[model samples]
Target: MTKRNKLVFAICAVIIGIIAGMVFVFFNQEDLINEDEAKAIVTERYGGSVEAVEEGADDDIYIVNVEGDTGTHKITINRHDSSVEAIETIAKPSEDTAADDSNTSQEQNEGTENDEPSEPEKTEDESDTAPSKKEEPAESNEPEILTVEQAENAAANEVGGNNVYSTWSGEGQNREYYILQIVDGDDEGALVSLNGVTGQVNKVVYLDVSDDDYGNIEQLIYEANTYADMVDGRYIEFDDEYFDEEEDDDYEDDED
Candidate 1:
């Protein structure tokens, strides 16, 4: 055979080998764990209902990021055999976890007023000497702004969800608007950043809520990333395995 014929045969052989390898891998692995089963396993092992469960890199494994009374547990399940691959426990639960941000901040700030130093009391002798300066009404120049209710309406209009709740979350410049939490209706559990002054809906962080369907999780993650892109804002975080950039780069290089 000519050199050209040999090259064609070699290319075809390589293609066939790749196809066969993929088929072998697929067939050897038993059925993967369903959403219910995966959650059950996580709860059994980690001692709580699974808060946030995700399929690991390319669906090869499953990830469960859950926090309980003990602490946070990140459990990995091999999709092939439906067995636990590794269990990592964090005693502190320091990461940007699945736990509600609103709840966390409230707990942190409730006791802050007590932590400040109290002012010293005025002595009877010094009180008489102290200047009795007359107080003047300050002039107001700030522009009229949207109310919290109006901001919540704007956020709900921007994203189709039940406007469950909203709170003044930040301080100073950071305290632009109410951080709105929408849930139950259309948008799973969305964290909407609403600009109270300008009445602009800024960023939204999509989150997972347990449902009968696993597609709920997929849609939550997809919207979380895609919607963030639409507004040029940041979305929610996922495990490293969920986005195996190295594996994707390798596949792209191979295709080229």
Candidate 2:
């Protein structure tokens, strides 16, 4: 085909591919759980229409959430057969009347209090009948963060370093961790991370830095992780179409 025609063909092919993918997805959605059926099942048992229907990540089930005059409920149903798998009461709207009930309960409690005798004040002369219960100790609020010694030991055991060069603490996903620099053994140029709380080894990394990179080893490790993340993100998209010289030439000719 001519250059202009070839470019037109490539554009047409891309559009067709996108449309085909959309049609496939649309039809496949019809085979999954029906939201209408889920609503009907919830309304029959609970006397209310379903508020929302959400498909679960699991292939076989759907979550049907319902809100009614009396309460709110979460119902699980099978995707293929529409059978009820589980029902859970999430909230009770009926509890709104609790304020009026509480007032009546308070009046009754006051009447009972008037009729009952008060306990005599504790006396120094009278012996106590029951001993007071001891209070338990309060838990510490401080996090179980890793210490340098613990991090060094954990890294040493994993990488076989007799001594630690340097250490620093940092935060990981849910908790704190420590990275230790190792030397005097086979792990001379290795870096290791240890969990702050459990003292378990988290990661081991190596770096062969030149004189120009950095004298500070910790900064180099951080930069290495950042570079690795960048390289990883580059592969997240597979754009082989960019390398097609035929398409490029066609576009260049059309522009000219």
Candidate 3:
């Protein structure tokens, strides 16, 4: 053969081979499976025997259809491990099934009716005979209000904020409580607690003291005026009255 003709024939053969290979792959793109493993997967998912209607390739996924008591399900198994990846139910219960359920319910109702004893109906006159009067609900008791002195004492004792603190009593949630204010050298804040009660400081929190002079007990009383409005009364008391007495001894030594 001529060189040109031989080259053309070789090229044609290569093209035909490529086309055939493509067609084979397109048609055989399903996973190949073992018969025993396929059956096991179906038994595990649906509790029934599975039939392989079609064979799949090595790389493709195997699809199996399982028939159950209620419906037919489609399950896909992996060719490599025989593990079930997906399952879908295909059949639905028919109208005759629904009608049978209704009939069963009706029979049960009829049986219950025959077993139960019916009570005699009362006449209109019996219902009309004297309706009993319902007693009114008792009035709710008001919470006791705290005295001004009691509120002041409670605020001075709670442990928080500054060394020097003051207290004021007020009414909240229908209950009497005391608001405590503390003033350290730099930090100033306040707390609220129930009057004469331990550990109930829900309402009042610490107040920020921006002014240095306001740390005095008198200023805390003025700032806590709002708490005073809610209470029976308000008052201010010093936390450290003996500080001056203690300083007097030191002052006498300086003179010596």
Candidate No. with top TM-score: 2
Q: Write the per-residue lDDT of candidate 3 for residues 23-118, one digit (tens) a residue.
A: 887665444456666777678867855645444564456678777556677787786667777888877557787788889999999999999998
Q: List the candidates' TM-scores in order.
A: 0.28, 0.31, 0.25
C-alpha lDDT of all candidate models, in order:
0.66, 0.66, 0.60
The runs of at least 3 residues in candidate 3 whose Cα sits more than 4 Å from the true structure, single-residue gaps closed, are 1-33, 49-52, 57-60, 97-256
Cα RMSDs, all models: 47.7, 42.5, 21.0
Instruction: Give a tens-digit lDDT track for model 1, residues 1-256.
Output: 9999999999999999999999987776546666667888777866865778887768777888777865778888876677888988856544455366657777779778678899999999999999988899798776566667777777777666676555654454455554435456643676666655676666667664445423454444444444455554445432224445767988999999
Q: After superposition on all CA atoms, how large is the RMSD of candidate 1?
A: 47.7
Candidate 3, residue 22: CA error in Å?
Answer: 22
Instruction: Write the number of the candidate with greater TM-score, choosing between 2 and 3.
Output: 2
> Alpha-carbon error at 220 in model 1, in Å?
99
